[model samples]
Target: MAVEHNEAVVLRAIKDLVIEPIPVPDLKDNEVLLQMGSVGICGSDIMYWQRGGNSRFRLEAPMIIGHEGSGTVVKVGSKVKTLKIGDRVAIEPGTPCRRCHQCKQGAYNLCPDITFCATPPDHGNICRYYKHAEDFCFKLPDHVTLDEGALMEPLSVAIYACRRGEVTLGSKLLICGAGPVGMLYMMAGKVAGASQVLITDIDDNRLEMAKSCGANHTINVNGRDKLEVASEIEALMGGQPEVTIECSSVDYSYDLAINATRQGGCLVAVGRPSGRTLLPLDVALRKQVDIKGIFRYVNCYPAALEMLSTGKINVKSLITHHFTFNETLRAFETAISRDAKAVKVIIHCDQ
Candidate 1:
């Protein structure tokens, strides 16, 4: 049966979110129609809902707002060869124009013509029914739940950040922020053979969660001086971190990352700092630290899935709350509420 109507969570304007009817998407030749199973509320989604935009993208018009999601294929397009009806899949959100130079160079995430879900003009997959390009969807294994499948988006991000930072065996890692992304970075770094992982956050609750997830050291940076925090991080790790992943978008976190990293090490910026973020450029330059930035991820879905399937990376604990599709507003509330201590909120869209 052809689906004709869809109900989606739409952000009409700043601080405005509503569940409304949307037109059912028509599948393209290489696309598949999905009955969305699970959708995770991300930090970006919160930004759009609260501020109407992030640093790079703005909500110019009403748009459905979810990028981290997984679904079961209800129908497959004629040219779709790898997937079929009833296949459960994790969506990789961003699809780049294949003819672009970036795409040709295997860095499709950098393609300027890419269409990323819930970013500006791109509508997302937080609906009862959604259609996506076949290549952007990765099939979920039998053991993987839809909730875990949805989490693949953020997991891929952590994997990519670790790759950029060159996390290797016995590498001392300092990750600033114990948010979902920060916690995932710690896990990914550990899997990539980092001997010791130190993660910092202002929230005690979040830091506690990080500790339960195998973080070697967790620090509460609330009201602490940046340099002092940096020194403490190095002391806790027994040496300066070879790779520092700054996952907190605060200026203090950036300063801590730069000051704490070892000389000639890598500093990968995973957080999107608002406006102009002033950092200790002299420290970074004098230390000859390699600073890099990642936009989403490139070719990391398979690795993320493999980690999940092999039990090498367990993200099940990261999921703190669940809600039905109709209770999306409440889910978002829980995600942004400081008292909720929510790490990952999953919306069961199948209902």
Candidate 2:
């Protein structure tokens, strides 16, 4: 039978969100129903909220705007033997076409036909209840909170980024940006066994937050150019870092990342740049630097949940503010403002 539920709806830009009743689809043979618990407001959510567009996707029509969410499995289908009702799970937002070559190679994040949540015409999981494929609903262990479950989405991306960057034990890391993703990358670095981590940001408050998250040193790039910031980071580390993670979409951040790494070090491009700009490809080529770009994340939810469940990384400090489902609009407003006062804004969907 079809089920009914209420979901927070973003019907237009710079407007209030509404909770309205909607029909939930009947569970398919490989699907499960989830009662959403907590969701983290992401940068993309803020962009869509303020200007009503993000890159290729735009608010051509009204859409729900959340993808980093966690919930409890309220119902399960016949084929779902790995999960059961009442199990807390992190729902993977993108459903890639499994038949694609990218999916076959275990890099489904690049699948062209993938339909991701929070994108235009793709209703997100800001609803009180949601139905998703059982295969994508990863069961969370008892020790992991729903908040941590929600964070698994971004953490997955970080994991993929770090792996692509080849970060490992004893790796000296420098991160550019102190937002949610950058902070999580610090935690990921720890779990990956990095002896020390360093981060820099324009916001002093965010740089302080990065210290709490395990940054061994912090650099203020407020008035410094890319090269100047790199010199500061190098002096702080006593040498260029082995791995540099670029978490800010700003061009200078990218430049700093490229210039801050050691001669043979790796640079991971994790953030999406806002505008087309020239980069120092010539310098990188001369130094033989390895550069890797991330699309989203592939097969990382389970490990991210475990990172919290096993206490390998702390995430409680990440959620500094909270909002009820009805206050999602306000949540986005605070997020877009780059309020260092608000580290990670969490929205309680079922409240």
Candidate 3:
């Protein structure tokens, strides 16, 4: 086998990442072995490298650091019937215990015992070789490349956000932040039939990216007050948005989002803010707005993959930078450094 030993990008401590080798273990009956092709450096991954913790999950010890990945199957366990050796697939990082109540209700992402990749106390897949549950792996279509497969993870988030926000035809949308998540939200909102999607961000580069990706209006709210921007956003949309997806993780952004939404609209928070933030509760109560929070996604991978395969959404533009497996540390540096103008950085796993 090509994978005689496994090499991974491990975070030993804050801002410390090194390529380390570990023994490759045999696959379980329900698992499939993969030769990683591309892995994306998500915001959480960057946070783990910078702060040793990403708001919710903190690194108590050394751990592999990535979950947005896709690869070609090198081996399959005896019990695996749906996939085979040499098959290309996108890996769903979260593996939920099928026996859990949430799993029974088809909300496996909410399962208490879910072991998500790159999260604390769980191993991730930013490595030369990875083993994952067969059921969680979705085969990529012939038209979708491995790079596109890796993007399925974030796109799934957008899909879930759109669903939670109830984005439909003629719906007016407002998205806070034009980062990767916000960019995905803009694209997903369009696919969900949103008539108008306005995105706000501090960075002009990101706002331009949002425009290229399908944002109806891009606002640079760098120095503007949140309340003032909220009013401007309403004016641009002709009125308050029917749905607002907050992806900035900033206190002011959240505040503005709540105020910019229509009286009976929906507000969805997708960003993982570092600490607790205040909300406009009085307005929410009086307006009867629907406030919802999404943690990861369930049953969105297949839909996301289909969207990519059919060309309903194009994610290739989202990838702004690329690095090799050995340049893992440099990749993290570029990801965290705003000067790089990095939207999404992909690490090509050398197999």
Candidate 4:
């Protein structure tokens, strides 16, 4: 039976979110129609709803907003050979033009012609029914739940960031921010064989969560001086970290990361800042710190899935709340509320 109507969570404008019926178009030759199972609310989705845009992308018109998602294939196009009906899969979200130089170089995430879901001018997969390119969807193992499947998105980001920072055996890692992504970075760093990992956040509750999830140490940086925080991080980790991943977009956190990293170490900036922000360039230069930025992720989905399947990385603790598809507005509210302490909010789209 072909589905006709698709109910989606759409951002009409700044601070405007509504559930509306949208068209479910016919699948293209290389596409598959999905009955979305789970969709995790990202910080970017909340930002778009509240501010209409972020630093790099803006909401030019109404757009459905969700990127971290998993679904069951209800239909497949003629050219799709790897997936079939009833296959549960995690969506990779971004589709790059294969002919692009970046794509050819295996850095498809940097493809200038890429179309990323939930980004401005591109619709997302928050709907009851969605269609995506077959190649972008990875089939989940029987042991992997849809929720974990959705989490592959953020885990991919963490894995890529760790790779960028050169996390290795006995490496010391410092993660600034104990949010969902930050926590994942800590876990990924540990899995990558970092001997010690320290995570800092303003929220004690989040820091506590990080400690429970395998951080070597956690610190609350609220109202603290950046240099003092850096010193404390080094003292806690026994030395300046070889890699510092800044997951908090705050300028202070960036400075802390730069100040806390060892000389010649890598500082990977994973957060999306709102606008131009000043950094301690003199300090970074004097320390010979290598600053790197990641756009999304490249060729990391397979490893993310393997980690999940092997039980090497457990993301179950990060899922703090769940809501049915119809209660998406309330879910968003909970995610944005300070009291909610929501880490990752999953919408059961199958409902």
lDDT of every predicted structure (CA atoms):
0.93, 0.83, 0.90, 0.93
- Write out the backbone clash pairs for model 4: none
Best-to-worst lDDT order:
4, 1, 3, 2
Q: Runs in model 2 with CA error above 4 Å? A: 1-3, 14-16, 337-340
Flag clash pairs in model 2.
none
lDDT for each residue of candidate 3 in 30-124, tens digit (9 for 90 to 100): 99999999999998888888888887688999999999999999999999999998889999999999997889999999999999999998989
Better of 2 and 3 by lDDT: 3
Clashes of each: 0, 0, 0, 0
Top candidate when judged by lDDT against the true structure: 4
Q: Each candidate's TM vs. the true structure?
A: 0.98, 0.95, 0.98, 0.98
> Which 10-residue window of candidate 3 scores lowest in summed lDDT?
269-278
- At residue 287, candidate 2 shows an lDDT of 79
For residue 78, what is the lDDT in candidate 4?
A: 91
State the local distance difference test value for candidate 2.
Answer: 0.83
Q: TM-score of predicted model 2? A: 0.95
RMSD (CA, Å), candidate 2 to true, equals 1.8
Q: Could you give candidate 4's per-residue lDDT for residues 91-121 as a string of tens digits?
A: 9999999998999999999999999999999
Evaluate model 4: give its lDDT: 0.93
- Residue 126 in candidate 1 has what lDDT? 85
Candidate 4 minimal-lDDT segment of 10 residues:
269-278
